[model samples]
Target: MDKNKFIKDNFGISDKTLKLVSEAEESIKEQFKHIENICEINQLRVMKAFADNRVSDSHFVATTGYGYDDLGRDTLDRVYADIMGAEDALVRHNFISGTHTISTALFAVLRPNDILVSITGKPYDTLEEVIGIQGEAGNGSLKDFGVKYVQIDLKHDGTPDLEQIKFTLTHMNVKAITIQRSKGYGWRPTYSAKDIGALIEFVKEISPETICIVDNCYGEFVETEEPTAYGADLIAGSLIKNPGGGLAPTGGYIAGKQKYVELCAYRLTSVGIGKEAGASLGFNRQMYQGLFMAPHVVSQALKAAVLCSAVFEKLGFEVDPKPNEIRHDIIQSIKFGDPDKVTAFCQGIQKGAPVDSFVTPEPWDMPGYSSQVIMAAGAFVQGASIELSADAPIKPPYIAYMQGGLTYESAKLGIMVAADKMLRKE
Candidate 1:
């Protein structure tokens, strides 16, 4: 069957939703132009130099540290620092996952009894076990080290509660404050780098001495500026999510002041050794290329999100495409209000996956989450692949959270397919 007819038969999408999709695509194109301009003006030279050097080949030699002088690694460390606009940056292909990076950073900064306040409620589901909420099913994390955990409430509007944040800082013995920029478990309200900066300012004013850390995964390259621009003491992130650009096989990054980076590096590699001596098996040259193309690629994803939000809203589903003006990035969530429709929508998107395809939606126990019945159809071998992923929380009101597309074409196709499926069900 033809694509349109197939869609009409399986899912019903209205003409109004289609029109909104077209308009959103146009807006996305305009945003892409702006992104291109920014890259050309600011990062093109550095990117070009990296491309000319073919830095990926030197990965083994550069990271070997077997017989290399410490001076060379130290110099490269300074260079990375300059790239991140910080006193120091440590770029290693060693951090295996986002959790690893966060764990290392926490270990570096927090003492055995130091207090750690999560300014953004509970963290992603994967962290629940690590943070002491769940039992010792997984690797023992920060909670295992005897650190105190605190959570501050967010305001009704979804931003952090400034007054409560101040109360926590003043009353609690908070040694470190962590702000997760992206939403937990693949659901994020479009937030930009500048928004992160504002949050940093708020924290600094209340407790200047307390260490401020930001989980910058899924947020890199989405905005022109970065969290470090606003004074984040340490920013930890996954390369595969945004900066990796679908190029790196797997890895994470930590950027911040030299002292903190050194401390984290020690924690990542060991108390005495650093990542400089670790195996380079984790870093991929494709990741470097992906990072170069990320700004434009992410712009396309954002466009898709905006378009999808408009389409879902027109179709009678409550939608929040741009929750806040400060949030200016990708990620669109649509409330299906029906479990079956949410499943069908996910199926439709999976059919359009670039890498692989499958449909097995069911309820299973996910660590760190009280909610049950989570479903995901992702293209990547690991769940981090955002090429096309849409899942909904199984609660009273079900909403499918969707984001990530390699290109505007695929993202638009996925949205159209899912819309068609929903329409057919109706």
Candidate 2:
């Protein structure tokens, strides 16, 4: 049977949808090639990190109990540190999620009187409770612990407000500041590595004592240089995102200067038992393999994001960082005005998934979010955004956030599936 017929018979993709996918791909060949170039540079960096750390069968052995003297765990930390251009690193499945890792980094460095300012305005929705900006106090939030929080909104053009940042840091006794490298739930464009580096320099020039932290969840390997290369004190993210390469079942990492990473490690375990306490359990190989594959996987995601923008923009919907733009993260947002359209698009994405394709995703009040979120992810690992997923908050200016594609081919089909359902009414 023809490939188009196969898709139509097996998945119900319309001929129009298949034609749209082809046109979108044809228009973005240059962008796809550009992603490949980035992948090549990043691949070299990962391979060198592994080889330099002497990764071998010995480093793949899993330990149990206290995990003391776990060669694999320790060596992998070194590998991650090298890749991040940081002095030290803490990588472990104990982190649970990206937000957890970020919270740990904040708690590790902040004290009762220390003021923590977010230069990127507000952070992702999940951080609202953690920062004590939302939810009840006395739950060990930053505010509950007496840590002051300040925010500087981005400019109307979506760039960082450097002038305001300088003014804020000039006189304030700021102890620490954070930069969210990814767009998160915002419609703003993601900051590139060079952009982040300049921000770090500006902040350091004004407030030399302030510790700089970056939430690097979806931005890893998107560029050759990470925030650490620009002198970030600490960078944290979830293993289920970019760095996991869609293979790590569960984990997170914080890589940066030795002092901060050591502090975070202590927080992850205990004061006396830093990185030495957590056992690799049975996940050593998967984590290592995931890092090895991350560069290529990230490229697949970038390509998908570009194609998604191309198709959505051509259809007269609003898209952030249009298809021709250089992306700093993997997420692609499409503004859908109607709630029903949001549901149909999400369900279409779910249908293209390899797992749970028969199931329809629906909106629910998921924890840690301000709004009811409808998430569609048919992934091998639950909630792994690296494997073709779309999620949206069912509200005004309802925009769907689509990301992750372990393979470009899979993501292309998923986009087509979504387009078919989304345009059915018209």
Which candidate ranks first by TM-score, i.e. highest? 2
Per-model lDDT: 0.66, 0.91
lDDT of 1: 0.66
| Candidate maximizing lDDT | 2
RMSD of each: 4.0, 1.0
Where model 1 places Cα greater than 4 Å from the true spot, the runs are 1-80, 136-139, 185-191, 282-284, 323-329, 358-360, 378-381
Error of model 2, residue 331, in angstroms: 0.6
Error of 1 at 296 (Å): 2.4
Error of 2 at 275 (Å): 1.5
The sequence of per-residue lDDT tens digits that candidate 1 reaches over residues 92-143 is: 5566777777877888998889898888766766666666766673366677
